[model samples]
Target: MYPDIPIRDWTFENVSGGTTGEPVKFRHSGKFFETDQGAKLLFDEWSGRKIGDYQIRLWGSERDIVSGKKDWMNKIYRWMRNEVFLNTFVMSEDVIKKYINVINETKPKMILAYVQSIMEIVKYANLNHIEMYSPRGIMTSAGTLDEQMLEEIQKVFKCPVFNRYGSREMGDMACSCNKNEGLHINTFVSYIEVLDGNYESCNLDEEGQLIVSLLSDYSMPIIRYAIGDRGALSSKTCTCGRGLPMLKCVTGRIIDFFKTMDGRIVYGDYFTHLFYPCTNVKQFQVIQDAIDHILVKLVFFDKDVDNKGFYFEKENEIKKAMGEGTKVDFKIVDDIPVSKSGKRIYTICQI
Candidate 1:
């Protein structure tokens, strides 16, 4: 820590990759935002959202919009871009009603949101018979977006949903194009390398830890830093004709993997893929309390629906994947809490 460096000298305030572990705070060159903005403009343009296009961002906190008088600068920025910022902290019926009203009226071109937050909005609209405004496309980040969740979001919004991948420390790394073949790497800002346990390049689609080198950060040089996530790079190119490289998948954090009693390591996606076909389930989380005991927390669309049979099936399914020695307990909840960074960690390992 450089205690002698004045706080004013450091330009950007950024937090470390804490989706899987503890968070660390750091400062960087003031020019970092400019570089990120340039990268984002390109990413958004690829998805049909131009710089001047009206957009809605579902990313601000309640304090940011509590009173227009309190944050005059944000209000002016919103006005200039014709954007709306929905609060993720409060999604009560009253709050959602206000969001629906504003969205229907503005009719923005794009809706950028955290995956789970947007899913919750769409779920509420479906459950309460609330009408939604149609945007050119929806872009989601900050959490994992499985196939089932993607289908539900697109079905409710009636628009193409693009998945964006990145972190606070790495800025915009990859995003899906119109083709949706896979996420294209932002080779302009960062150099990404995928390596196996032996630290060798994985062939084609083999899963490995993502080591990123930030080319833009000169004030605080970061080279081949493990951002604490698992993914794979595609040897194939995109069909959309973009020369940008592709990523096969960005599964959840590597630390979330659970070790079974039999010493088998199970990744988080193994549990995520299981609930993909369950339309009745809104969201779920898995916590490995011990080697032989697992706790499953679930949020359903309909609270009254009979999940007894479904639980029985899931028990057997989980047992098969995690080994029959593990016992799983299911608990239905109203909501799943997010981390301090406003992202959801679907899998929690107590071991």
Candidate 2:
């Protein structure tokens, strides 16, 4: 249906306050078309090359920067560089000393990273008792920054906490609106659809799967891409008065009931309440290393020196939360592994 519409026709403009203006914010960011092609070529030429992900752009330029010109050849030559470490990308330090060094030496008021890593720091501080923050977004608001732990984190850290959501395929973020909890879609880049389990489109008030469509497609056309995340659209408009469509919430990835050792498939919100309340605990990760065994890695310290009270309390609580007849062991480790993008998954249930 959209075959004739040129990709360059799309532009993200600020229509805040219901006032429509010329499209001034024309710049598009993130992985460009040529960059992905270059990455693929390097992977092919190098004998032992490792390819992380593949990106495709629709009708966008392949240059380092988007050109105002509308031409046929948009692909440009570029190099792919893997970002090593967050703190060290600014300067390289070993992982062991990175966090403490940043907190002690740099001593910045607030620090920002992926959700999982920030949670880890919080857990460590709760167990050991330390404070951390980044200059921006220490307090999550009713607008874009609102979150489950936003209030709790604010009470502890007393700073702004912002929530940002997006994916590589979706182009840019669907961040919390500055005006309210409503998520502002990157209406500039992709078309969004909310769908139910039966492949039917969901209404404004219903929970459903998020189906995204990329408006631009020079490198690769992502038409009606079913991103694993679930979310829904909202009927309410913002006080900020932008007439554009709004998204309500991202429900994260959908899951089926996991059959336990007793042959009962369990699915509910029970797991959310388990570890999240360990107020002082900063980060928690559960990895199913074996069929009947799981390993937990946490970064924390305690004045008790041996960390007897908090440690045992956590283990017992986990066993209770999970259920009976399940023998799971928790491994207290100094470090936890994060994905290439620095986001860590809390509960990695291996089936």
Candidate 3:
């Protein structure tokens, strides 16, 4: 779709997990990386960390791991950047214990992770009475960070938790400053707007759809892009005195935890990651009907395609995380409906 941007200029190619629809493959130019790095620098400054500080990133990508690139790439990157990666794909008790051990060994100055993933770690740590190395700050992204989750994370880690809001299509757009009042938009690289049903801008503090334009991505300019999120802009200035604009709150991405019969809690994003490579599926929803039952609703691009084999293959993996006795049912549907708020939530826990 982006034919104007030359292939040589595309430095990074990635596929989003498609929380709302089918997976999307997008390319980023070298300039996009520069702006992304700049945004991280701003986050560091706001979080009271300096550049080149040691940090551990709790992130995971099934594609990277399957392609066998994450192992060597992470090793080299860790050596050059003073960073470490602990995959959050599987959150079993053993994995969480390993994560804690890595943190205590590395003693990173900052811990950056997906909100739900780190929340799982904190929950496990608290329950098991496991002590962790306190970092200077914690940065959360990729999921909704509510007030309760934020407070719990701060109490467990004994550090300020900064919530970051962004997407794969657009690099880091807004992040909470040290003031913790709200997330300040990276006005230098992007413009943000909150719109109502009429597609007009909403008043300050009025909840609406978030529309963003990447000012720095000229190669594949994204203008007035409806970013599939609901948020509001703040009217008050931050006490830290940064002139950047702020988001009063982001309330669009809501993912629930899936529980196993054995009392294990799995992050909702794990199921989303499971279907990232299923390009034939147009959209999907995972619903935990009971502790040992899961119902998956799928809308495929071609309704006539045989999907039984796909279902059986993924069913085993789901059961592995949810319990061996778990019953996973896959139903092909004509459409997966959105919520009353016009958002397509990929994961839901009815229990």
Candidate 4:
């Protein structure tokens, strides 16, 4: 899936999210990181933070934390870069409290984290009326941030919350400027296109699959690579006045598509939208176990809150979308596990 560059010439190997299926590895040249720095520089300039600023990263899982502790070279590298790493996979009350204490003590200038991970922290802090350290800025990636999530995060952090769009295959493809209008494409590192089902370019503000061509990865030329997520290109220029183009929004992963019995495709966002108005649901995951069967696992904030009628209505909606023959089952669980990369896979198709 890449160029004929020798393995010895590659500088880094990264894996895909593997949320829908098996993860694929991609190799990068030395210049890849050099050009990736351009995105960081842009973000720093936009957010009023520098490269050497003290930053805390809420990322990875418990296993990653254990392995990271043994990697002394990495520790030294992070120290030199003025960075701290905190495990965000498990957000138990104790773990959240520990993270809160560390952030207060370290007082990092910036906090970088996955949208869901930081939202968990925000939820905990808000519930306990806990005071959090006010960082200069917060950067969120890996997951989408709805309006509610963004507002809560800003309220708690009292800092600009910047949303970044990217993948392991492509480094920082785009990021929101201080204006927070939309994500500005990292034109220095990538060229982006939003194409419809016909493999033709989508009009401005038209939602379609995003294809990216990496400008700096000469070792493995990834051209017009479909990154699987759906989004749209924007015609409106950002108020920040950056010449870089903008993406209106990233809808969801293309792999989230579920095939119905009659050969129709149901986007996973359909299931996610069902839970949007459900305030009692703390977390949820939808899985297409087979062509005609869907399993919904949910964690509720209040177990005693009876939502049988709500569940039945949602089941009917799912059946309407996936075909009436489709079997929709709901399961209540204590928690849902995050992916190895510490991201919540909201939907999965096991076909």
Instruction: Identify the leading candidate in terms of TM-score.
Output: 1
* Candidate 1 lDDT (Cα, 0 to 1): 0.80
- Greater TM-score among 2 and 4 belongs to 4
- Against the true structure, candidate 4 has what lDDT? 0.82
RMSD of 1: 4.3
Per-residue lDDT, model 3, residue 160, is 88
Q: If both were scored by TM-score, which would come out higher, candidate 2 or candidate 3?
A: 3
**Where does candidate 1 stray beyond 4 Å?**
1-9, 60-80, 93-98, 128-131, 276-283, 299-306
lDDT of 1 by residue, 1-351 (tens): 733534345565667755555777766775666788888888778767888898888863343456546488668867876677877764555776778787789898999898867876786788778778889989998777777788888888888999999887878999988888889998888888999989998887888999998876656767898887888899889999988899988876876788888788898777877874576877789899888998999988679988889999999988987898888999999877766565666788888
Show model 4 residue runs off by greater than 4 Å: 1-8, 61-70, 257-280, 290-293, 301-327, 349-351
Candidate 4 lDDT over 89-138, as tens digits, reads: 87666888899999999998898898878977887777678889899889
What TM-score, computed on C-alpha atoms, does each candidate reach? 0.86, 0.57, 0.70, 0.85
Superposed model 3: Cα runs more than 4 Å off? 1-8, 63-75, 254-351
lDDT of 4 at 75: 76
**Of 1 and 2, the candidate ranking higher by TM-score:** 1
Query: Alpha-carbon error at 156 in model 1, in Å?
Result: 2.0
Error of 2 at 203 (Å): 3.6
Model 2, C-alpha of 155: deviation from truth (Å):
3.7
Per-residue error (Å), model 3, residue 92: 0.7
| Candidate 2: residue 198 Cα off by (Å) | 2.8
* Candidates sorted by TM-score, best first: 1, 4, 3, 2
lDDT (Cα atoms) of all candidates against the true structure: 0.80, 0.46, 0.78, 0.82
